[model samples]
Target chain A: MRRLRSAISTASAEFQRHYAHNRRLAEELRERQERARHARPQRDLDRLERQGKMLPRQRVERLLDPGTPFLEFSSLAANMAYDGESPGASCITGIGIVSGREVVIHADDSSVKGGAWYPLTIKKIVRCLDIAIENRLPVVHLCDSAGGFLQLQSEVFPDRYMGGRIFRNQCILSKLGVKQLALVFGHCTAGGAYIPGLSDYNVIVQGTGAVFLGGPPLVKAATGEEVTVEELGGAAMHTSVSGTCDYPAGSEEEAIAIGREIVAQWDRPRKWDCQREEPEEPYYDPDELYGVLPDDIKKQFEMREIIARLVDGSRFHEYQPNYGTTLVCGFANLWGWKVGILANNGVLFNDSSLKGAHFMELCNQNNTPLVFLQNITGFMVGRAYERAGITKDGAKMIMAQTCSRVPKFTVMCNGSFGAGNYGMCGRAFDGRLLFTWPNHQIGVMGGDQAANTLAEVKLKQMQRNGEAVDQAVIERLRDETRAAYLEQLSAWYSTSEIWDDGIIDPVDTRNALGMAITASLNAPLGESGYGIFRF
Target chain B: MALALLLGAEAAGIEIVRRRPHLVVRIDGREHEVVERDEADGRTRIELDGRPLALACAADGNTRFLRLGGRNLRVSLVDPRDAAAAGEGGGDEIRAPMPGSVVTLHKAEGEAVLRGETILTIESMKLQTALVSPRDGVVELLLRGEGQTFDKDEVVVRLASPSAPGPSEPAPPEPATAEASPAADAKGAA
Candidate 1:
């Protein structure tokens, strides 16, 4: 038995040696083929890639491995031209390895007609996509296009019958199983925005970048809405409202950082568990909101300041900054799914702000949860009225406030009075829940206004009595009495009868809100895909 | 069935004519009496529900284009689908689906067209129908005369259809968003 075991061991060692030698020889053969491929003169490829005109190779080199690389399918392609210099066709697509794993990169050359999608570039883009399908690789598009080249595009597609069909033809490609991401640092507008919107995520910088569907010139002819280039299409537009883009950073470096982080985190899509269902704060102190607001309710403060305090530390995206300046509407996270909010900014009062009400109303129509900050010095009072169309705007705001389906809550940080109060979800309104600070006041006017009015009335009565009364002392007395009445209204069975749900402590405002919002009838509970809108 | 030549063609579930078409068409699955006479020239008088339904068309031999109100019709000597499909070996023919001008041709003649390959775009009523290749095939023809409108169902090109199985192709998944269909009237148009 011992002699048989020794013979078996010797035979196994010889077999192992043969197997290792064969694997080494196969590896050597692969290296020889690689060398031969490199040795073959590639004048056309080298000429097309002269100077830094085409960055497909460089992009792959920086993004993936330079030597240990995967083969690129369409390294050199001519657009429209059957044979000739098509100028690298705006977009260059190829395969490469990232961390030894294959990935497809389609890098647009801004040098090529400012990276426009003339009819020539369209097919070039499809070339990369086909490669993605043939070899299941994630797609990374480095886009910096000005927009569709209408003039060149017209010259290219001579077929009169198939005009704009080319533009909408990419509907199915977007749904294909490719992990897509877009990086925009240059002019991305009009048709340019479509590619980014279709991608899984987009990273953009603030100052150096911009994005919009149809630029200002087109917008002017269509809608007559005038604004600066950046104002019309900026980081804020995509990140907050349209939900077109996922990340917005201040600089290119920041955008790259965010992109890197996103790539690291992006595992195949999974259901996010909102396990921390607790509200950010408790409902004990409504007065804690007062700390965020200025001491005097009559003195207006930015509602955003209050919102910052209420939301989970900087978890909000406010949209339409210039369109509706007064009332701020944005998408924010309470636990997981985004909640839409439209709150009144107490300090800023103009036609701009009233317009914000109508905009917020639109958000309401969409069934996003709203939060209204109470404190506005009433609507604008001046020639600023008729010119800005504040009347139609105000009515629209009221109708929007009336027709909301999502749960709404309001905090009376002070100054919940008049028309502004109704617009900001005052306790008297149909807001889901209303809370107030200890210094809460809900009346036709502020305590200061009431004090002045009452002091004059009392002084006149005293004068009629022919009794001694100091004007200064009477003013002080009136003010003190007015303040007492204001407090009394927020107390026990007064506001409790109708105006308020409950009062919470100042410090517990965030927790209280989290509780109210998480506990309140959460709305927008419906199947996804867009349905018919009454608008 | 004692069929009028026009009615006979329609009974076979086929359309041989379009513009100023001579064939009888079934609407709501019912046929109405129509007369074609020429006062100055030979034109058709369309009568339905005991009333004259307007029938107008521009015509020539081998093809006559007709329009009765918004309904469009075209008459042809041959079946465009069969002619194109037969050359392509029983694959869906990528044709000018609508009467519109072609804007661009993405591929050359004899090139293979994959499913969903954008053959060309057609511009009609300021809207474009991206004429995509319905199946994988080697292009047999590329009739991309940009800026010229062709009648609906007109043969634009033919492809030698691919032998292997094609990609998942889209049929009529959805109609134009603006096209008012009876099923969806939940909200007034924005």
Candidate 2:
């Protein structure tokens, strides 16, 4: 219960510099979000309005409870994909409260490319469904997509996690007793038709909404049958004739109102309430987190200072505080939910690896959730450390962490390389959620280190082959490899690939973690046990 | 009505016996003079029988941990019904719950100390874990101290049974004075 005696100098020059840099970064993030939100072309909005249909965003606004928060995911998805054409992947996904129940909202951005499912659009949709499944929250699909983007079907249609996985996830969700309501506002043709077909409830708008395996043009092409879209699969036909949809509405407003009423009829869930003290502002300003993280990934900063700014009231109960020098393990409250924190202060040596293993087990035993703050260069590897069985020690940690039943969250605060990524619950470990900061980078090793190591290998090979060891060739190799590493290691690149949930601003870490933790409580804690250690 | 508390394994009956002219608390069977000396900024300073003790106490539900004398002591307010349901056991010797290296010892072997007095400090994961005495008695053996590493549940200190003194028993020395020790530095740092 000890309130941390802060060692950070809040007013120091370094702190001020960090605060200024972070403030600018936060501003840039806001600008990007604003631009992405407003990027829809004016013509598309007018066209939807002319057709007596509401824009995707307008539907979401009407569906959610008034004045509630909406935590959007990948707002800039497909920004770089589709040759920079698809804005927000031509779709919108977020968590918002509707009918006083937290639900995942998946809306189609018809303004972009006629709401076609680009490769990135499929990705964004799948990710949102994954969130719905994990949190056990009901999903409301604002289905208006124009099927798959034919120009890039190669990328969208043939992968395990692509177009087909959408229906697969919906089936899994239904099996788990989670509910879904589909509001069809526009055409859902071909593969997209299954969105409403698989949902537990479907509401279709009369004029624009259609659900069919093949649209009218496709039907004409396949069988030379000329039929109108409304006669083939419109709201009236589906609700009365085919019985495919549950509710039929005359307009967009009527459809959303019906969706809200249906959600209210469903049983309310008993929210998980964690044992906690009243929430308090952190003793130290979270802004200081900017100053605490070094601009250069190679440099080190005190992790406790960052923890002080993230936890409730900056209070912590450190477990086994002194022995493991490179790792800090303790328990703190994030938004009043108790979480066991394992943050790296430096590289993982034998002692730190063992400490991590022990701390993870303790958290699981206590039914506390885990949060990993990773800024690591990987496990210590040298003659002295190898002699101490560092590899086996690291394996023990990985074994324990992999088997832990409690939910885990991770943040790549800075450098994440090699085995350190696995040890810290990186992408491979299936943490409930993972995020990266703008300055964060991840690779098998640092760019400079990888460049130097590869260059050395090539130079030695040239010597052995009795060839001229040109310094120019070696320099070019290093530069090329370093550039390639930097490109792949950027947070934006990782986020575009869905390597993490999203890239969050450093200052928004508290709220983001709070929301994530709350959402994670949808599932009960699993039984505690871990794999056998290597001794 | 009475309540029992288990502070790091030692059970005690605590009751507010009197509240006039300064609060009096009965710990176990003895009444001690107590008062809230000062309380501000999450820290509480209390005078126990004339000796001032400063603590930073945080309550999580019914379980509270007090950071006193440089140690985080998990204090649980036990329900008398539950305590009577579970039969008592014995682990008279002090043991470590996790593996760690002993940092510093405030007293030597065979030194007499009061219940709840910190015996030594152990360092693990950059945290100093204070090893406190569960009962007032002579320290019959200081198993591990000062730079020595020990495993989980390994005894670090042992107290003589209240009646029979162990072998090599030294006369119970006067209780160690607080003014000359470094433990004073731990007051209110929480």
Error of 1 at A81 (Å): 87
Stretches of candidate 1 off by over 4 Å are A1-291, A347-353, A382-392, A458-484, A489-498, A521-535, B1-190
Report the error of model 1 at residue A470, Å: 6.9
CAPRI class assigned to model 2: incorrect
Model 2, span A1-535: residue lDDT tens: 5566554455656557666776676676677667667766788878877888777888899999999877777776765555668877788898889998888899988877788988888998998999888778899999988788998889889999999999999999999888999999999998889899999999999988999998888899999999999999998899999999999998899999999999998887665655666777788888778776765565555677778888898888777665565677899998998999998766687888999999999888888889999987788765667888989999988987888888899988887888988888998886877877877888887788889999999999999999999999999999999999898887766776667777778878888888788877886666667767888
What is the C-alpha lDDT profile of model 2 across B1-190, one tens digit per residue? Answer: 4667888888867898788888888876888997775665757788878888877788974689898757789998886534552443223587763456888898787787654456887754323445666545678789985999986558888788777764555345443221111111211112
Mind giving the per-residue lDDT tens digits that candidate 1 earns over A1-535? 0000000111233334433543343344345333322332355345434522233334445555446534432222341142323344455555544443445566665555565665545655654554354233456666666666667666434543222333333344455454666766666776667667777788876755678877888899998988876677777777887677788877555665565555555444232222332334211122223333443333333455445545543445656644444456666655433466666543224444455555555564565666766655455434545465655555556655655555567776655556776667665455655665544556666566678778888898889999898878897888797767666544222222224543444445555555444434312222323222222
Local error of candidate 1 at A154, Å? 81
TM-score for each prediction? 0.31, 0.75
